[model samples]
Target: MPKLLVTAFDDEFCDEVVKVLGSKGIHIHGGNRVVSIDGNSQVDSVSLENGSKIQADMVLVSIGAKPASDLARQPGLRIVENGSIWVDEYMRTNAEDVFAVGDCAVKRDFFTRKAAPVWLASTATAEARNAGTNIYGIRVLHQIQGTISAFSTQIGGVAFASTGMTCRACQKEGFRYVTATAVAPDRHPGMLPGASELKVKLVFADRSGIILGGQVSGGFSAGELINMIALAIQKKVTVRELDMLQIATHPLLTSAPTVHPVINAAHQALAKLRAVGRELPPVKKAA
Candidate 1:
């Protein structure tokens, strides 16, 4: 394994990934920029902007990428700063009868409503379907205003997943939120064969109790668990509602009957919200 760094918007999730990578004897140089890559035709060393260099036989330089909007620009279409074609919620471009989808199209954050730089085939396909359905007029009842950006990755067979926003993002966007984390065994009895620990984190808005986002890391089930959370965010599921969410549990497939990590995390947030409510000044009854 060589030195690597994974940079993203989610700080806590990135920290968890760094720990997982560290456990696998992989060093992560996070929050640093690659100033130069000293390599020939094959490979060489890499230097960072922070006066640090990593000697290497082969280096993979993946700084970043922007949308290739050259073709779209030829038709005099609007382009954002990232060179992506500007499109409305229905993937409709400013030009009449012109539509854009996929990586070349602009994206917005689902919760924050800000211009998002997320590029994913899932988003692309969803946009494509919306655009295809609404070519003439608004046939679909809903349109994609922003992307939730659900994603999952694995390291050493340990899967990590996240959807929607993180606590770091909530703070940066000035959203009033409450967050909680819970860890439970993925399999019942805690001693089942192939059982792994599952950790879940959920964030909710303080006032409305709406779920903002969630993150999970554990066995292969982590991937699906994240999609559930993504759906919760999409449907505007509240913390109180999630705390009471019901699901069937089995010994071989899931955590203990008393320890569903997602519901448990939601319960923790609900508890905090109750405590905060107790501390607030109460209103006088209307006479």
Candidate 2:
């Protein structure tokens, strides 16, 4: 029998991708690297480093792109270790009056301030706007500092999106964190047309309750939903504040206000923090 295998790095987003694709009859061979492709006249199969062979009529490889910095190098522009043009926060190159943006420019991590290999059109657009406005001088007081790595995609009729860091990433980076998840129908009533179960998972700092990341999986709304989470991460919103957020909802358009997935997930995180006897930031009383 023939099969489709998708090998990917072990991460929360890729795990969700595997689950969604698996439900649609696609197999995922994650955490396995393909060592070689065996063929005669046409493509035959791929051999995994673990001594496993996957029969394949075709192979689709999706390695990430490398920055083409040859042009920038010609002018003695500083190139980072990752083969991308070194650029400041305003996308200005080391050369006088020269700027680089998009995939060719290096990006830094929002939290770590280290060089990050995140190349996306959305990130590039933000860089371009900053570079354009600051061409003459540093007119823009506030500017993009680093890449958040917000990403979203649709697979098997389900929209899966994530922003900021994942639990695995937190562990690897030695961050003390807590996570919580909630599920609710996208529409107020489960019987509404096009209603889908929206699942939300949130990660927060262990004691401070500061939101570190979020993941959403559901209908088309998940795309915008992840953007909201990205904003929350950027603003360093705490679980308590997120849980108390006021939201607009309608029976046909959104889930019940009482059971909104994002808010509920925050509530769950707060409970987890409390259960662990972690000291949480005091909530400010509205004047």
Candidate 3:
């Protein structure tokens, strides 16, 4: 097999990624820039700003995307500083009867309310639902306020997923936060066929214990588990509440009830808070 190198500017969750990929002989280069790709008629090698050269068969670039707001600009629609068509929570644009959604529309961070450059088909579908219902008038009372940035991908036979604010993002936004992690087999019995080690890491506000974000890695179950975490974040579920969340478990399908990674992770966070002598407020009863 050919050696592979993945490069990135930041180390957001790269430790976890490296742990997974490194076991499979893949290399990660964080905090480095690709100075140049040395190639002739066909690709040859790549050079990095850190004075490193990597022989490569091919190079795949994933530098993210930008909004193609030219069409909206021609119509005189308001454009935000990030180059997306400005839209309200209901997906309504500044111009009357104009609505924009998806990649072409501006998005704000769910917690920070700052411009976020997240563009995903799932996000677009949610926006489309809001826009379609509200275009005739505000029929939908609940609307998307900001992008949660939920993402999931499979690599080297392992699934990885994350959503909402990461630890780095929280730090950058000046949020005091706590993080906890739990790991267990996906199936109740470690010896069960198809069982894989599922790991869950959750971040919460240090003071309120409200879930900020979560990441999951393991088997196929990680994909759906992260979605559940995303919903918990959207609902502002606190560690105390999440620790006591009710969930169903099966020997063949999920982790043991006593060791469910999500609940266990929340429990771990709660313990960390208590260890620090932080008094936690009672979980509010849902109205």
Winning model by TM-score:
2
Give each model a TM-score.
Answer: 0.89, 0.91, 0.91
Relative to the true structure, candidate 2 reaches a TM of 0.91
Indicate the worst ten consecutive residues by lDDT in candidate 3.
1-10
lDDT of candidates 1 onward, in order: 0.83, 0.84, 0.85
lDDT of 2 by residue, 1-287 (tens): 01222111125556667777888888877567889999999889999877999999999888668988888899899999679999888888999999999999998887777788888899999999999999999999657868888878788998878778778678878989999989999997877889999988999999899998888888788889999999999878899999899889999988899899999999999999999899888765777
Highest lDDT model number? 3
Clashing pairs in 3: none
Please give the lDDT score for candidate 1. 0.83
lDDT tens digits, residue span 187-277, model 3 = 9798999999998889999999999988887889999999999899888899999999999999999999999999999999999999997
Predictions ranked by lDDT, top down? 3, 2, 1
Error of 1 at 192 (Å): 0.8
TM-score of 1: 0.89
The order of the candidates by TM-score, greatest first, is 2, 3, 1
